[model samples]
Target chain A: MDAIRTEALTKHFTVGFWRPRPYLALEALTLQIGHGEVFGFLGPNGAGKTTTLKLLMQLIYPTSGHAEILGRPVGDVEVKRRIGYLPENPYFYDYLTAEELLEYFSALFGHSAAERRRRASALLDEVGIGAERRLQLRKFSKGMLQRVGIAQALINDPEVVFFDEPMSGLDPLGRRHIRELILRLRDRGCTVFFSSHVLSDAEALCSRVAILANGRLVSQGALSEILAVTIRGWELVVSGLTETALAHAQSSAGIRGATRLGPERYALELPMTVPPEHLLAKLVAAGATLVSLNPLHDTLEDFFVRQVAAAPEERGLESTRG
Target chain B: MRAIGHIAVNVFRESVRDKVLYSIVAFAVMLIAVSYLLAQLTAGQDLKIIKDLGLASIATFGLLMAIFIGIGLVWKEVERRSIYGLLTKPIRRWEFILGKYVGLVLTLLVNVAVMTAAFYAVLAYQGWGVDELARRAWPAPPMDPALLSAIALILVELMLVTGIALFFSTFSGPFLSAVLTLGLWVIGHFNTDLRNFENVVESRAAAWLARGLYYALPNFDTFDIKAQVVQGQHVAASYIALSVLYGMVYPALVLTGAVAIFSRRDFK
Candidate 1:
């Protein structure tokens, strides 16, 4: 069974005022997240990423439809007991020491006194807060605070962990540590759902991704399948072409697109089907020498822009498929 | 229940660390000392005046702690975004509110205890006329019987105020909640006078409206037996029992409403 599933899940928030209209934040978002997979959700700002997380966590009520976690309805206490959430820009009680904060959360999760101390100690160490567990949160830097936030989320040994923009505001080293932690969580057979706007991280870490735009699920599936349909091609450059040769080369159209790259050099885009030699020989026959040939592949970002910009019906097909 | 206890413990610790508690304690002590000096000015009312002032300070300071700190408790959680972490746990919203209320009450209990001890120390020191020479220098202590009754009344009063503060916190911001709670306190203090005025009204409809308002507001004066205790009148245990019951029931009603509103609120 999927660790997470949503069918026709929708949420509308009413702006409380004299004259009001409900704003739809998530429109019929449906997807299934399998256990032990790192599912990446990529979207620009206000694409309903945070709203989806909020609804899943039951911080706010959904207008219609339903979402389930671990076979239980969303917001069920049993489901909540197995899930951990790290909110974007998490804030903590400034007066609490790292150890104290973890202990507090552990108790809330029904950990015994002995288990609370043991787990808190281990988590503090795992998050690299071993040496400064006694220091108050106010004294810690932003990166340290983030580490503590992660520790607090993991205190329950949750089966599912949701991280909303976990890498925001972190230094390069901090970002790498978070990525490693995410990998470690996934390795432990925990279902990890994290949201990010940066496509590189999603491409590198996620086996599958869901892209959202304007509060709608645009595309979602295995990263490979999403890219397979979007074409991949290479770039070719040629130089020393006369006006008649340029006209001939342009008219022949062996390459997909030919545009001037330099004073006498022009760049040609060729589909992967068209071999580099055929394009080079064509340029040579047309009285132009091949200057540069480089292959370019489609990235997750390129696919994101294309998928998010596509028509609604076509976009929904990618997300709704099993 | 365990989660509530955990949150309560943390809130108690945080509140104790605030400088305001110590300042209130020090101020109460100073008030008790000043009462002794002021009592010296009145030849025969030393003990009576000291007891009145001491008990009054305890009640006032305790109320201040409850209203000011309770307003900030939930507001602080929202402002710092800690509510997100708490909500994600396996705890209910009512538990959070209950825990915060318990923690603030605990803080008030400690602060009031300190002031009570200081007041007792002052009374003990002044009760025994020092030496003949000291007694000659200082005026004789006054005989007061209502001090105990006043202290009991103050406890009941603080309970009611804590409830008011928590109820206001459910739907209002810190500043507005504080103001509303203070307004309730002021109205409650003169609740008996309002009832008496309501009784004297000539028009039946106007009297009914006045009576309705009086009953809707907390009848705080019913808890006070200070005059009877001070006058050396025999105050019945039933009076204290009834006052404590009144204090308990009103706050429970108010807290129920607070929890109802809080449970439905969307913490976006």
Candidate 2:
């Protein structure tokens, strides 16, 4: 059974104090996420990423359709036993210490006192909370609170975890820390579903991805499949090239173009059809030296921009993209 | 069951840590002490005045704690977005509402208990305050156990107020919730007028509306025994028993509404 599945799930929020109207926060969104995969739900801000997570969490009711986790319907109490969730910019009860917060959540899963203590202590350490720091969460930094949020979510040792904008509002180091933790969860064979507007973070962690724009599913598949992981071309940087050799290199059928890098230095952009060895041999014979040769593949960021660009009517909303 | 307990315990701990609870309780204690000075100004009626004011202080302050803190019981979780993590847990939505209500009631219990003890202490001190005054006021000894009956009803009233606060907060922000809860509390004391309201009103629709509200609104005045307690008049045990039953049952019904509203809500 799929770890998570949604069928035509939709939500419409009645906004405005007066003359309230139903605003389509999320349209019919259908998704199927298999077990034990790190799936990234990629979207720009206001693209219904958080709205989707809230629906799956059953924090809000769906206006139409339904969802299920581990073959159980959403809002099933038993299904939550196997699932965990960390919200965007998670806010815990600041009156509680990190351990206290974890322990409290542990108790919700019916853990024994000793088990609760053990789980709280272990998860706190796993999330990088020190043993000596028993300060209330209100006193902790944002990064520290976020760490506690992760610990609380994992207190039940869930098999599937949902992270709503996990790396949001974190510094580079903090983001890296969460990225590594997510990778570790994936390594443990836990299905990790996370929403992220930051494509780069998703790029390094996701095996499969689903791009969402304007509350609709734009595309979904393995990252390599969607991005069409083919070598676009080679970036060839060379120096010590004679002017004749440089012009000859630019004239080559495989060479896309050449630009002078500096004195006696020129870089050539080549199509994938260009043979690295043949180019090197010809360039060597012409008294040119190779500095660097690297293949460039399609990037998720460019693909994301292209997808967003394709939807012009909705393009205006992309101005607030994160 | 366990989830409710956990949420309730957490709410109690959060409320205890609230400086507002402490400030209000401390202010009540200070006010109870001030009652002694005010009582002295009345000469012969000093002891009676002290008892009356102390019970009044307890009821008023307890109501404040119930309204201010109770309005935030569920609203705070929503505003802080903490409910995002909580609702995803292996617990029912009704459990969350029940837990918050139980937790806030527990906090009110502790607050009322402390304020009651302080009030009793003030009465004790006045009883032994002076030689001539002590004998004069000692017809049956100053600290009557009947005062506890009044405090008991007051606590029940406070619970009802907290439940009303929770009920409104399910569908409204803290501001509107407070206003509505307080409005109900004030009108609850006067809703007995609605019993006779149908008799005075000319319009049949207005009478029916008044009767509906009379039945629907909380009857806070039913719990009042302070006047009888202070005057040393006998109050039937049956009256307190029925009032307590009504108080417990009313909030439970209101909380049922709260849970239904909360369950249907979209926390967007």
Give the per-residue lDDT of model 1 (tens digit) for A212-290: 8877887899987888766577788788876677677666656678787777788878778877776577668877887
Candidate 2 structure quality by residue, lDDT tens digits, A1-322: 9999999998777766666666676778899999889999988887888889888989888999899999999889999999999988899888888888888888899999999999988887777789534888889887787788888878898999998888766778878888889999998989999999889988999999998877778888899887666568888888889888777866774778788889989888888887777787888888888899988677998888888766435422222222
TM for every model, in the order presented, reads 0.86, 0.92
What are the runs in model 1 whose C-alpha is more than 4 Å off?
A234-269, A273-296, A309-322, B130-149
Per-residue lDDT of candidate 2, residues B127-223 (tens digit): 8747874566544357789999999999999999999999998888899999999999999999899999988989999999999999999999998
Residue A283, model 1: lDDT of: 68
- The candidate scoring highest on lDDT is 2
Model 2 iRMSD vs. native: 0.7
* lDDT score for candidate 1 against the true structure: 0.81
